[model samples]
Target: MFRFLRSLVLPEAACEEANNSSRYENLFKKLDLNEDGRVDIAELHAGLKALGIPLGKDAEEKIFKTGDSNKDGQLDFEEFMQYLKDHEKKMKLAFKSLDKNNDGKIEASEIVQSLKILGINISEQQAEKILKSIDADGTMSVDWNEWRDHFLFNPATDIEEIIRYWKHSTVLDIGDSLTIPDEFTEEEKKSGQWWRQLLSGGVAGAVSRTGTAPLDRLKVMMQVHSSKSNKMNISSGLKQMVKEGGVRSLWRGNGVNVIKIAPETAIKFWAYEQYKKIFANEDGKIGTIERFVSGSLAGATAQTSIYPMEVLKTRLAVGKTGQYSGMFDCAKKIFKREGLKAFYKGYVPNILGIIPYAGIDLAVYEALKTAWLDHYASDSANPGVFVLLGCGTVSSTCGQLASYPLALIRTRMQAQALLEGAPQLNMVGLFQRIIANEGILGLYRGIGPNFMKVLPAVSISYVVYEKMKQNLGLA
Candidate 1:
């Protein structure tokens, strides 16, 4: 994480007082591109790119605004020198804060202790990972020079800012509700940006679900009603839905589906944080296995809390226009006729599905992002919008493929009572029944529409999220 900062600063050691002026002059000459003695925005951008420091537009604008003290929209050598000097001072202060023992070196233990005070508990090993990023000589520690060199050109003024820089991974909502929630820093939480981000995500999710409600409804219908006796392709399935309940009916269950996003996200994030703490080893270490377990447990916790809504969504989607008045009516009818247990009809399979869905989603997304960075990103690791969307879509689809059987079973169980004269079955029984009656392919019913909705859903969610973030001052 901190290693990425290395590219932002001039390669020369800025902390060295000796020959400092000459070093700055040389760097300025390099950035002046045409020897005009001034570094304009274009020159600065190209200079940074040449130096392998690819900053975002906002970051570049901020730099120009701050460093161009003359209000000329450009930087002269003197202004550039002063800017580096001030940046170094800020970096020095940040380094001192981490060197708690006043030993002039930031060790792994120091890193752990400092972060622990900030409510971010990490093991010595995790601290080592952080140190490795900035520890240029593999001394397992960072001295003032190393720290200054690492962050001299970085815009971060404090530890939180550094973390924010490192936390710059793209968070795409690919319309799969089962994917793990994004993590937030303590600073983000305290400043209330975490909630804003969540709100942005929620708004994006609502719009996406609503936009694709018809496809979603058709998926549920196929999952519940498709069998050996009935075949449902995308075209015929959509026609049947329109014929059965008119156009507006396609959004039958979308309201509850959208409504549940807040609580589910809130619970999942809170539970994930708590579970991470609990899963941390004696040294506060959390490895991949621990993280996976924490995420899985947190997901299960969230699903358990808001699971009845899942049933409601399924029921409403599969219901005819006049089958029930609304969400409340559907809930009342289910409780009255089928008892409270009916609300948890497919609880087992739903909970079980979280493991594969979350695991594979995380794995595939990381793999894809890493592959892209390794092959395509020579100067910057940020995988622009399309790359991120492509990775998210592909990863989410893989996860869906892995867990669709369980999802289909869960949907069938949720809608079992609605199937006149059909027998109710437990998770395993339903699996057996589907395999016996409809063949192996029965497990993947409605997968076509489920997949069909991914690209557009992701695109809409991403665009809406970016817009919401901009409006919320998060962009």
Candidate 2:
């Protein structure tokens, strides 16, 4: 808070002495750029900027609000000093909490243990990453001076506030649906915001899937039926579907697709948290590798649990009109004709796809976000909605590109039994056959339609999610 401001303003005025009025007066005069008796937000911003501290508009406003004791939109010297004293006390308490051993310094172990108490487990290495940011010197630890200096401009009032500031990210549902669900802060969970956010995301996904139902259906049809003998491009594919089943048939499988969002998201989120804990290193930290593993496992766990719905969706999408009445009817027919095992025909390829999809999606997203921050953070810490969506779309497309072959194979296997004269091939056999019969490009049969849906799906999802978040009081 303002405590760090005093240190930056008057470096030699650290002592709490009543006779230090001259030093305080000098500091106040320096900040009062207009030669007025008070300092306003503009002056404060200019002062911080002069010191090479680039703070966001929100942070600057927050400081003004906190220090303007009389709500006069400015801080007189007395008000400024009072705010600094109060902030100093809070900062000291926070530092003490992290300095668990009372050694007057915050180390990696201390950060790890402290965060663990708050249900945030981190390995010592990850803790070191945090320390390195705040530890001005190469000592790899934070003393009172370094801590105060690092947070001088940050308006976080407590340790939890500081952690929250660092941990929060703008999570956008712009990528492959199979990617891991967004994480919620402990505060969000306790305050019931987590469910609201999840609900918003769920509604967004449902609408997105519905809006792109025709394209999704076409993608499935091409993946299962397209061959060297039967070429299927987007224009021809759409015409065929309309001719065969009429316009309404394009939404055949959309019911189950929308219905699975809630449970799949819930299971993925729960499994992700559990897997992260399991894969954490001995120091209680999860690194890049651990996160990738956890996310992939979480996706697989969710996909496995709800895989029957997937098979049903593919069946319904490829089914002609009157083939199945609804989701229940589709399930009944699949169960009656092919037995329980039929629901998991393409399980291997589906699960295998999760690894490449989740890994590449996460890695690319992180890389893009990191690069964006490195380049643009000096101008603004918050990467606006457009930037986030762009990164997510690019990362998702990359992931889809890498995993589309497996996905196509899985779809073919799922529908093989239903297609007339189709061979019931296992995962590997299907791959071999596709390559041999249709050539290497055959593995990417439905990718055109799949890629075509990415932009529209993401745009619809983001717009709907934003509207829903506002309605839910989450924005």
TM-scores across all candidates?
A: 0.75, 0.73
Query: Per-residue alpha-carbon lDDT of model 1 for 50-159, expressed as tens digits?
Result: 87666655566667766889999889998999998888787888888889999989999998787655544555665676677677767989888778766655666677
Q: What is the lDDT of residue 257 in candidate 1?
A: 90
Residue-wise lDDT of candidate 2 within 381-444, one digit each (tens)?
Answer: 3455677678778888998999999999888989998889877888888899988999999999
**What is the alpha-carbon RMSD of candidate 1 to the true structure?**
6.7
| Lowest lDDT 10-residue stretch of candidate 2 | 166-175
What global local distance difference test value does model 2 have? 0.78
Most lDDT-accurate candidate: 1
How many backbone overlaps does candidate 2 show?
4
